[model samples]
Target: MGEKQPNERLTSWFVRSGWSKGELARQVNRRARQTGAHHVSTDTSRVRRWLDGEQPREPIPKILSELFSERFGSVVTVEDLGLRAVVPVTGAGEVDLPWSGAQTVQLISEYSRSDLMLNRRGFLGTSLALTAGSALIEPMQRWLAPGPSGTPTPILTAANGGEPHTGRLSGPELALLEQTTVMFRQWDAHNGGGLRRKAVVGQLHEVTDLLQETYPQETTRRLFRLTAELAHLAGWMSYDVGMHPSAQKYYVLALHAAKEAGDRPFGALILSDMSRQMIHLNRGEDALELIHLAQYGSRDTASPRTAALLYSMEARAYANLGEVNKCHRAARLAEDTFSDVRTGETEPDWITFFSEAELNAENAHSYRDLAYHSSRSPLYASMAAPVMERAVDLFRVDETHRRSYAFNLIGMASVHLLQEEPEAAAGLAHQAVDIAGKVRSERLNTRIRKTTDAALRRYPSVAEVQHLSDRITTALPEYAAAG
Candidate 1:
């Protein structure tokens, strides 16, 4: 037998984690049970053995990776823990999601199935690296490529080899699906993604299954569009809760569905959404490419509102990269395009949500980013709060936009901090916390902590700051525990 050697990599991470061996085992066991894995029997001895150079098993490596990732507030992987790579159990990790044609059905089915498994089991963490913008070129080219017939793919007829199945979709059934999507979007906007991501994924699965059955050309296009919307929702929800890898997968699936439906405008929206995720992950360059792709691809088909939203996202990406001039330029374009919104124009249901208020909120975020990253901190910071205030006021008028309202409150509070008004910031942060209790979003919770920490750093002696800090701990105990 080979001489036993210590697992230096695992040992280093374990020591850095500052957790007792038993605590590590307990957390892993607790997470396993929480995910319905009652059979896992990890204990301190097993952890000790792993440190002493044993590769414990299949799931321990995965579980440990997740636990450490959560503990450290960043991505940790099995390879980083020096564990042997095992074959993916469900092949979900190995599945190739091609971005074209009838093959899109297979892509949707497989990806949605994998997503459901993760939602149900919570057994695995996202190990897949996000697809970079440069890597998107081939797929983007394929998407923009015109068909040989210069038309949409002809929907398959039963005689022409549509799958013979019982779950055929009717017009009413399709309409119901659309209505359900609207309801889901409202719910997502009001609360957050963590609460109902599974439901969205489940609906995507059902939609994918229905796609396997026969339908007319119009029905097929509608089904594909619905699939795209649902997948995009699922993606956005995943992103909301900090599931970047899963979010990336869902977003790509949405893009594929959009292309399959021959819906360029929707595809642009999906691309824009993906760029937002990349921005959140601090990949601003990649985000810029994505926003540009969305802009160029949908230039003709996108309405004024959609164009404005895309430009707003571009400004956000530029702000993330500290490009103050580019950010302002894009923001102005967004504003100008927004001004062109005339009454009674036909707009997508999704795009209709990006009203003036939403545009203001987004631009505020861009300025906030610039304030953090540029020399004109006072200039950008001063602009952020008022725009955010306008957004918050508008958002408050709609009960469905509580999440947006809460987020804007945080943004305004952050600007207040930059303005040296700790008391005002504390008050706004307190309102955000109150809203946080009503909404269930991890992203919102994280923002509360960050803003809270900033206030504490600046005005720890202030009564309101001290009180707000205490209130945040009570309102967001899960985050407090993680911290």
Candidate 2:
């Protein structure tokens, strides 16, 4: 029964080309139509059956062959694609996780490809249990080692000598990618993950193509850094959309790519990001461990801004863990580091986004969390309320940051609810959800839910609170996942 089994080769190729089962079917059907033959009405089920070892009838195979060949930049025979009858099983997926540089490269490629088809049911979500702590332990160890310098093996040149191949991405294209990353960050801040998820993922797919082709060593290193950065962005976008398991996978891929690029700093940032994801998932211990990993990895030469960001994340973890004193100490350290910053310093471009506004917004969230969960002091919310107001004021003129404004408004509204001021809370909730339409984010949706729940619980009989909740339900159906 196992002789002719599910073909791993075929599945990998299809995923590498970024085709969903449905997409592959659609492409084949479209190709058949272009051939002027009787239109083949193929469904994703047919494609799934094919993946499960059912050979297609006649010209369908030819059509698929051409489609994959064109997209993958090579000749893809039906046999090569593992579509023929009695094709051997190439083992069940990539069963082993990677460790070395070569293995890491292979791992990232597999990961991006799997992303198109990874079963959502298998993701860890809010739990740290899937691979347990083992999944992260090895990578963290490698990240702590001094960043690798030049390899001893002669830096291999492309076939046509040291020049960039005509088919490869030019310097301008790479520069444009950096520019696009900036735009993506801004878009994510204002609009949310759903808006740019596909765009960043698409860029990542194209970059995989670039990485596959031969390029200069210097170019390759820079390209790896870019790939790492983009992958982190893609991961962040995924996390923003509530795809936590998938987000963790992408972050791991980004961390590996950064290490390969000799970019220890970006690796630290990605680790810190993973920690934040853990905290969001309510896995506080995991968050603290990951933050300490970041600090350990970057301690040798972390810039003030990077240090500040790291410390801020540490504060977040401590607050989540209900360690009020640890949280306060970390937050104060972050503030002190920020205060010491001056001009003429070379900082990672990504950290510049973490200004006083960003820190205050983060601190506001920490204070709010501490108030609600651990300290249970009305004082925490009172402190958080003004800081959140300050964040709103900062984000107001920066139209590209309306989502941040929305977040701060949500926090501020919660603070008012804590103070038993229902009208003030309802008014802010109304304003926050008004902008929620423009920012299609699951995180923001969670905030909406939180706001509604808090408002209702604080003053259940109040008409304005009821009306605001109804408006939220009506306006942002998709974020709410309402049919």
Candidate 3:
């Protein structure tokens, strides 16, 4: 095909297919309505603009492509809609559009309007391909390498004549960011963070680059803090994926960014997350140190609810260290702090979801933890069930928190098994395993495996427990390997 003007190409395609501009516009509008989108006017002038190489925003182009595909009984792409120059063909013979700043903003806005309507659901195709590429151990190894000796590259200054820099993000943009964060968090919680870690990490890299290159210093600082939060999330995903060292590096980087942002509250939250990771690694001493750091760092600045959360974390550390008295003291402090928490107070965005019941649930966990470490077998059996039940009730609204609830149930089951209540323990263990099957959480699955393995070992004659254990083993190969 000879090089031709975009308008000429569009018009030629329409002519050869015997479609008038008006008809195409009508078809596009009809499809948009079907998707519950605002119907664009199918006037002659609008159609003329499309034939004149004007690329209508998002859904319009997508709708046109779909309509054309249906009309011609062949694949129609953005290129065939007079945008071949803007969107080039990939090596895989698919039309690939560059997701630049403007495009990202637009896509995000569209997704906010109706995520269900977006053609590329779950993960973007490009993101999926990049994740597959990064699955090779070497690439991840490189990302985990130490920083270079030379000074880091300076961030690029925004262009003088470029778009006006807004000191603060618009409400819509902020909402979009928050929504995206929640969606990814839920996905991470239910599923092993492995599946979407690379994609979210890539997004953090992109957003960080854009913010640094385009924003003013003050805006850049705030943006960097948000970027750091995303980085922390990426690290959490890495930790969930068994890439502990890589996760540590990301956490360190996030800590540096948070400190630079002068956001003590956020820094404390990151520290709390770091402590949790340490606990997972069985570094109880290290976890305790980090939890103390978090409590101290946010002592003056944190809200009552946040303070309660920090204290709860400290209690967990104390429990892990087998300090029952200290654990009880911290748990009481958490409860007292939570009692003073007021509704509608300007709390940090991170802990806004915590309520009185949630605090009680934390106390429950503290009791359960204390029971676990104390080897008070009957106490463990008694407290574990009620605490886990309360936690599961509170977390029912959040799919991501469901795994934690499930893990707690598994713990309760183990406690029952220790008391020689094999029948009761087997029933609870089976329930935990069943819930674990629906979620993508490796952590929850691992917890189930451990509890069920113990139960099966102790009560070899329990057929139901044996079958549940076998099913869990088959569903999660990693759990079997780790076992």
Better of 1 and 2 by TM-score: 1
* Model 2: per-residue Cα lDDT over 348-439, one tens digit each: 66667777777888887888788878547688888788878887788777776787788888888888887788888889888888887677
Alpha-carbon lDDT of model 1: 0.79
Candidate 1, 1-483: lDDT as tens digits: 998889866887788678999998899899788767788998889889999999877567767877876776543456556676442323233224554556777877877887667535321225455565456444554666666667555444441355554545678878999999999998998877766778888999999888876666667778889999998998888777666667777787788788878899999988898888778768898789888889888989998999999999999999999998899999999999999999888777887789888999999999999999988899999888788888989988978888888999998999999899999999998888888777667678778877998899889899999999887654564332232
Report RMSD for candidate 3: 18.5
Instruction: Estimate the Cα RMSD of every predicted model relative to the unseen true structure.
Output: 7.7, 12.7, 18.5
Candidate 3 positional error at 102, Å: 25
lDDT of each: 0.79, 0.71, 0.59
Query: For model 3, what is the C-alpha lDDT against the true structure?
Result: 0.59
The TM-score of candidate 2 is: 0.73
Q: How close is candidate 3 to the true structure, as a TM-score?
A: 0.61
Where is the poorest 10-residue window by lDDT in model 1?
87-96
Best by TM-score: 1
Q: Which stretches of candidate 1 lie over 4 Å from their true place?
A: 1-96, 118-127, 136-138, 148-151, 154-167, 478-483
